[model samples]
Target: MPVKLAQSSFRDRTQEFQSVAERLRKSFSSGPGQNGPSSNTSRAEEQRSVVAHQSEFNRRASKIGFGIHQTSQKLSNGQENFSF
Candidate 1:
């Protein structure tokens, strides 16, 4: 996928994840102590965690295009190897 497209999708996912996380946090904070998280809260936390992972993936993907461009330039200049 294009970097911009991937970034946009990642941002959307992150927003959704953050929304859910916020809801869960609010619920937990409003509840009494000593009880475990509710099922929805647990699921929300899981989903939000995945968003963190996806954000990292998006960051790596963002660098890929720049890396490829630099590598191509190096190869054309005989400054880097193109063969395995």
Candidate 2:
């Protein structure tokens, strides 16, 4: 059997995946190998900022691969609806 979900629910799940990726990136940046916990860590901060930038890039890339990037649409009633 195949798993299925409502469109909105799927959107929520994708958002969760992005959140997890973000958290993992943060954890990776803060780990012992990346930088020390003391002193000015400007380079580490720059790398962290890069990761933050790439995270959205990765998320949109995945969303496009998963065919879920069109989850946002305007309804006839002038409200937003996500359905496919």
Candidate 3:
């Protein structure tokens, strides 16, 4: 079955997704104490920070994916005036 969505709504969702994805990319690219090269202690901290950031990114991505899925389902169910 083909699902129909308003052009503006599709664009809005795409932009929102891109914005979040960019933010996540930026955050994940930078680790703790990103001012300069890391010392031994800072290296450990950086590793931990990387792990934490990865976990957070995964959680947020999962949430966003699920939300998108739900919204898509709702839209497919003939809900036209929906906004997220």
Candidate 4:
């Protein structure tokens, strides 16, 4: 029989975080009454930067989850040689 393992919560948590980050970015970019064009542009850029970093974080989290799943599969299949 194939080994079964519970999925990790890291991806779920990361997705939640990404949602929050997106909201924040939208709020920041849409704020009203900025003093000048430069200020408004800078704030928009900052929001983009934040969202970009969050996306990178989510990608890394997904990769980690994939690795964990692979390891679990190997252990279940009795293919892993090392003991934990």
Candidate 5:
């Protein structure tokens, strides 16, 4: 791990290592978002999010389409059916 290396790298000078270690510790622990193994967005997760969004969009669009079909049917009620 980089943290171990950072801590061990300063083994020769205890005082300097202590101060750098404190800084490194703060840097590592400062934020929940950036403290993970890989701070960047994972490709698989991004793909999953995109798929989720598209699925939601399709669901909403289908609902709207059904509503439109129902409205058109009601509007055409009792009217002569014309083949177009």
Candidate 6:
């Protein structure tokens, strides 16, 4: 016998897997940086700036990808709702 899967089940699993992958990618990508801290004040400021930049980039990229994914999913559903 052939195996079968529900649509919602596949979508939920794939989304969860993708989310975990993204988190791992982000964590590993942010490696150590050079330019040691000159002083506590300056170090703290630099760290904040770095975090802000990374967050902004991640937000923008996620937004774009999410929009595209939504569109593709709608199209894939055959543009019809069949209920019984």
| Top candidate (TM-score) | 4
TM-score to true structure, per model = 0.40, 0.32, 0.41, 0.53, 0.45, 0.45
Worst 10 residues of 1 by lDDT: 3-12
lDDT of 3 by residue, 1-84 (tens): 999976663234888889999999986788666636545477788899999999999999999999999999987886556566
Runs in model 2 deviating more than 4 A are 1-40, 68-84
Give model 6's TM-score versus the native structure: 0.45
Task: Name model 6 segments beyond 4 Å from true.
Answer: 1-38, 79-84
What are the candidates' C-alpha RMSDs? 20.3, 23.2, 24.7, 23.3, 15.3, 23.2
Local accuracy by lDDT, each model: 0.78, 0.69, 0.82, 0.85, 0.79, 0.79
Higher-lDDT candidate of 1 and 6: 6
Better of 3 and 4 by TM-score: 4
Residues 7-82, candidate 4: write the lDDT tens digits.
8765448888899999888767875554578877887899999999999999999999999999999888895665
Give the Cα error of residue 72 in candidate 4, in Å. 0.5
lDDT of 2 by residue, 28-71 (tens): 77745555554237667888999999998999899786664344
* Model 3 quality (TM-score): 0.41
Model 3 Cα shift for residue 61 (angstroms): 1.4
Give the distance in Å from residue 13's predicted Cα in candidate 6 to where it truly belongs. 65
Q: Residue by residue across 25-79, what tens digits does model 6's lDDT show?
A: 8756764453334555676889999999999999999999999999999987865
Q: Which of 2 and 3 is ahead in TM-score?
A: 3
Residue pairs with colliding backbones in model 2 are none
Residue 43 lDDT, candidate 2, scale 0-100: 61
Candidate 1: what lDDT?
0.78
Rank by TM-score, descending? 4, 6, 5, 3, 1, 2
Model 6 worst lDDT run, 10 consecutive residues: 31-40
Q: What is the lDDT of residue 30 in candidate 6?
A: 61
Better of 2 and 3 by lDDT: 3
